[model samples]
Target: MTDRHELILTCPKGLEGLLLEEARQLGLEDAREQTAAIRGFGALEVAYRLCLWSRLANRVLLVISRFPTTTAETLYEGVRSVDWAEHLEPGGSLAVEFSGRGSGIDNTHFGALKVKDGIVDRLRTASGERPTVDKLNPDLRVHLRLDKGEAVLSLDLSGHSLHQRGYRLQQGAAPLKENLAAAVLIRAGWPRIAAEGGALTDPMCGVGTFLIEGAMIAADIAPNLKRERWGFSAWLGHVPALWHRLHDEAEARAAAGLARPPLWIRGYEADPRLIQPGRNNIERAGLGSWIRIYQGDVATFEPRPDQNQKGLVICNPPYGERLGDEASLLYLYQNLGERLRQACLGWEAGIFTAAPDLGKRMGIRSHKQYAFWNGALPCKLLLIKVELDQFVTDNRTAPPQPNAAPAPVEVARLSEGGQMFANRLQKNLRLLGKWARREGIECYRLYDADMPEYAVAVDLYRDWVHVQEYAPPRSIDPDKAQARLLDALAAIPQALGVPRKKVVVKRRERQSGTRQYERQAAQGQFLEVIEGGVKLLVNLTDYLDTGLFLDHRPLRLRIQREAAGKRFLNLFCYTATATVHAAKGGARSTTSVDLSRTYLDWARRNLSLNGFSDRQRLEQADVMEWLAADRGEYDLIFIDPPTFSNSKRMEGVFDVQRDHAALLDLAMARLAAGGTLYFSNNFRKFELDLSIAERYAVEEISAATLDEDFRRNPKIHRAWRLQAR
Candidate 1:
């Protein structure tokens, strides 16, 4: 009985509860989510069983102990205090991985080494032998997480991140973790869909994580069975019978299941960049002959013609964050909408996006929507009824009048979005009024250059060019949105004195190459800095978002002044405008986070012209992970995460409108004592959930963050300033 040990498992965020339920269904007691990981005290059998059976885990880390440690020295002491002699061999090779530091520690390597030395020292002291550190193939793995001054250390029972799932032999540029993909499918209700042998497809499948997970679910294949070995296998005095019973049962279940040809599942992606990897991923899943993947644009993608079992189409499309060029992206979106209505009949469509406005383009009355993280970008996976025309016409009419004061619309509220949209809108409006100053223009740039929203504006002298953008609006219909933008732009020609012939309204599209963005953007060239001495607009609104955000103007000024000598950290910083403002204000240094390489270049230009280009630092990362990893202090920190975003390729979804408090708290944590955290969200009716500001001195600085151009619409920015006292 002494052999029975306690172990904790962790699933990715949001799947903890489900993983716990799964464990419960298996009759495993004390199995539940603990923090981002899961916890369960069971015999070594449960630990081994979970490794083979879990479908939604990043990895299975056995908890050696969970303790509170504040500093580097404390972490070492705590680690040394653990009974390392109980597990690691004196002469064994082991490794330690440190994650979730979040502006707490400066160097992760130092922190990881400290914990490692502590473990080895403990072993050396007792056993007269020490284990060599092997980061890749360690005999024993240790995990150290220092999040917000607290540390949770666990033994890495699953050598690789559990998401490895033993599938996906090849790596794509941004492949979705298999475990995350499974969670997405499950969250989207895949079991219900899979039970019917309903086919499932991922149009943007980079490496077939979703498709494989879906297939595994269909075949009853345990996601972990493919892993030839697990950490517990090497445990001393391991019970072979119990482990064998679980492994054999799982294997038998997978083998005995009928894998109706993979024709029921498919994946398609336009960029052939993922084709080779997709093939490898399918092969790795042992489903090369079972699943099909095609290299093509989603617009032209047709559902499997042979199989009559219409299935669900789940996809994670490109968003403005990483794939800029909004107007052009509209075409892809409009076409996808067309495809959703046309090709996916009788089949349900699951569209995951951080951009709610983009979701509207699909033109379907969604059956369900799931909130998740696509890295730091807040996103939603909308499960829309495929029979849209019928569903919309028969079920949900055009609400009598499109813009009629949104009467008593009862959204079967998911406890997530948090606030009443109308109430939040009312508050944001009152707060942002003092900041919206009208620069003479034909149209007010609603989202152009605002946080989360990346639409831009161009100027021709007094008159300005306005481009309309909907930042993944969930409530608005895309076709209606398109009409609204057209109307807004139509008035621009009359308002700006530029004839419709010269107006040149270009709906932003993805820039195919650096040459295209620069070349196309240069076409309608002219210059002006009309209002507030705002300069530099080459022909106003051409290819992408104009030049600047009229809303964040006030906030930029704040940065310009307060930045004089403080280090600046810009999370989700695009175009480097804020950094320029900070550098111009005499900031010591600026670090900007953005995934797009194009915008980084543009930011470099904006800063270079202002003589602060040399001070800018750029990091291409999924903001959530990056911010979690960043321990560097900044005097001024600016984060404007998108309304709804998910880089399914990155294993998380982000929804600013829903995840604001958490995002703000994390960003604020990075702020130095007495430093300023300037956070903004363009979620129209954003309400800062003050409850989360408990850790810091929080204040609503909406008026201060608002810019001159956004004076007309007071709800453009939900801005705040938080300070760590």
Candidate 2:
């Protein structure tokens, strides 16, 4: 076989260009992008060098053979054509990673199995023995690509993705992959920054990916220097001597680089649990002495006094991974902008996020932006120069230059609709304010799209206001709807006498699947509020629906009133607000079930706040799955699932309108004789199946469930009391 072979390097999407640049830097010629993977030509030594040094490439694949293959038999024949015995010893282990689904292969799993079968059969024919497949760690790893009726087989030169630099054993909840982190640093010009003796900081560094990767770049350390194994080490054509020579040269370079004065690197994490893991990663990378991980908040981030003023402040700030996180993360991004402005005057900052719109809230002008990918989510790296001119001016700043044209007045502050919205808000506050105080309700809906133009729901949790903008119809001009939304948001602070910062704005719409429960922020700031004589925790910014659903207050009150020495069950128990009411209502025992750990924690905090630890249970489970398995009977049950949910945590999509009947049947199956099921949903057009009504005694309790605060929008939710006939 020729020592030179066709080569392909796969990388994360959106980083193909970066990988191409990296491949060129590693002396690979004729490098060009091929979908998400890069194609290149290089000799065996060059390929071995890439496996040891290329930071951005995920896998280094050496193309072995290619042939036209459409049917499964052709794919198997193509694989059989390759001399498998030459690559893997009989009775040894092998693995196949198949991508693409052309050539009649409809499933990747099935394609991989066919390739595996070819390898086993060929090896069995050659030596009367077959290599067992090892999915975890195979002696020989083969990659098969099926494209346009063509099958190309290659040996993975890297046993694992090169991004696995063998340094990080622990990571944050959403740490950037090591190679991705390196790419971000490269885009931010971290190597140049460090070479010039500038300091580096990641205010929201998770598990020290950026810091460790930056250290490696600055020290010129080969990314995989610490990695002990490579696919080539076990290959039949392995050139051990050539690899040893390259490894020795890399080791010498790293040792000499480490001897120099270390670059200044710092990482800050708010979660203390991540701090130690970050420190562990740094130590594992042999960068403990160079990079420092600290437990600190981003708002308090300041460059070390001994560090240089100019460097890179890069972080993959918790991008709103869930629907509701965007609102809470707005403040975080704003805080980051503020910190960059006040603390690091000359530093360059890069914020990587999936929701680039949140970058606008950061209050800084991006000098440049680069596209990247975090797994499948399209994202951007926003680069900003941390200087006074880039910072947002204070509201009280001096007027513009005398010769400058007058700026357009903001529509929210002076629009006619703004006044009407404000007036309606004031009227509702007066009407509901007194009622809330008299009833000890610290949180209540003050407005529910009361005005046509102002299509938003405003709620008050004591002093703070939660603003939820209902998505306007396509018939309405998006710009006009946005203007009206801004006007309404502006009106809330003035109308409610709350500070602008105290107002949290989130766009609320009928969510598909599990988007409603996805995390949008990790501020972890919960405010306590009194409701139905119990204190509950509500996180306005971190979630679309604050931990407590204001519309459910009446239903919770009824649960409490009806619970006295009776077992109570709260299903779809978001934040367990209903369970709290039941526990406080003197229930004999209470059980709460939901799938979100974040909400479950909030629920625990709410229960703890009320000092109700007696016999309440909190479980993280899919309500539908839990209901089917539940054999215990409860005297009372509350089922208020989301209108629709498609969370991957659940087995299938849940449409309250479509699945309510089955859901109610499952809940009723676990109900004691004469027990009542208070089934409700926010599906505005929900119609109770007449068949269900005929089989059981059912009463529409929606009207009775609406309190003084929610009467304005009784369609917000529907409720019914069902009993076994």
Task: Residues 1-725, candidate 2: write the lDDT tens digits.
Answer: 79778899999998899889889888788988988889989898899889999989999999999999869998998898888767888878988999989778999999999999988888885437678888878899999998888888999999988998888899878778999999999999887888898889999987899999999999989999988888877788888999999999999999999999987788899989898888988999999889998888887888655544578899988865553343456557666776877788878988888867667556678989999989888899999998867765444221222134334321112246866888898888778888987787888898988777788888888878888888889899987775676556545655666545688888888677777677666777889888878888888776667778888888999999999889999998888989999999999999999988878888888888999887989889998888888888899999888888877788878887788788888888888898898988887788888788877889999899999988888788888999999
Q: How well does model 2 score by local distance difference test?
A: 0.83
Off by over 4 Å in 1: 1-4, 66-83, 98-114, 125-128, 144-153, 171-173, 237-241, 258-263, 304-308, 321-324, 388-725
Q: What is the lDDT of residue 504 in candidate 1?
A: 40
Indicate which candidate wins on TM-score: 2
Query: In candidate 1, what are the lDDT values of residues 437-508, reduced to their tens digit?
Result: 333332234233332322333322333334434344566576655544533432333222332333444544
Off by over 4 Å in 2: 70-78, 83-86, 103-127, 304-308, 321-323, 397-454, 469-725
Model 2 TM: 0.68
| Candidates' RMSD to native | 19.2, 9.9
lDDT, candidate 1, equals 0.65
Clashing pairs in 2: 325-520, 325-521, 513-645, 513-646, 514-646
lDDT of 1 at 186: 80
